[model samples]
Target: MRNTFDFTPLFRSGIGFDRMLNALEAASRVETVDNWPPYDIAKKGEDDYRITMAVAGFSQDELDITQEHNMLMVSGQKPAEDNAEYLHHGIAERAFRRRFELADHVKVVNASLVNGLLTIDLKREIPEEMKPRRIEIGSVKAKPKAEAKQIEADNQAA
Candidate 1:
């Protein structure tokens, strides 16, 4: 099925959300189905996340996971065995590249592989000043009468 929608009005509105618009444009260009390597992304806690990839025939030494420039890159290369005598080799034993976009302040905690599953953990650390805080609005009281009068005289002189 084919579908169409008018986007001219949105472009002309000038709302000034350039970052979101650029992200949408970039997402539209991505080919989701082309790279079929199975993977899973899960949230471990309030600020922790995990990414797991299914790599059946890959060795731990052949796989690599790295974080660079706000991007998580997972790659692997499997070399063919020397004494392979199988009539039909259906399993995928080739090189692959996978990318995951990381948010600001998010960082890689650690990575490990066990039982053909590669797990990568991540955590986001928010600064103390950035977190929400309670303000004592009602606790702030007015100054004394003498202090108020002195401030008034100073203001009048100014």
Candidate 2:
């Protein structure tokens, strides 16, 4: 059974959160989970993250990684295999594509393939202006009386 939610009311009231709501709706959908070429995501530091995938049979040329907006896609395509007779085929040699959703300001730093693992490093860089800062609050000064008197004298002269 799949649990579905009604976001109509939220949409009617909320603003500037369409992307998050869309992601939530997409996640709520019932879809088949792909287990092949399993991967792991880990947080290395406060602003650093890593993704590791077990791609045992894939080569550097056969794998691809791309980031578009907030989406990260990784795909692997195996070359053609020669025809051979096999009694029992247990190994999985197939093409696979995986995607990950990245948060705003998160960017891919580096990627490396070692042995059978594909590792990708990521970091979140918040712009200086977007970061929080203490606002200076000083006493509000009253309007100068000289300027008010000058305005009144000018009006009388006019």
lDDT of 2 by residue, 89-120 (tens): 87777999999999999999999999989999
Tell me each candidate's RMSD, in Å, in order: 7.7, 5.2
The whole-model lDDT of each prediction reads 0.81, 0.92
Model 1 global lDDT (CA atoms, 0 to 1) = 0.81
Model 2: lowest-lDDT 10 consecutive positions: 149-158
- Best by TM-score, which number? 2
RMSD of 2: 5.2
Reference-based TM-score, model 2: 0.86
Each prediction's TM-score against the native?
A: 0.69, 0.86
Q: Which stretches of candidate 1 lie over 4 Å from their true place?
A: 1-17, 80-86, 134-158
RMSD of 1: 7.7
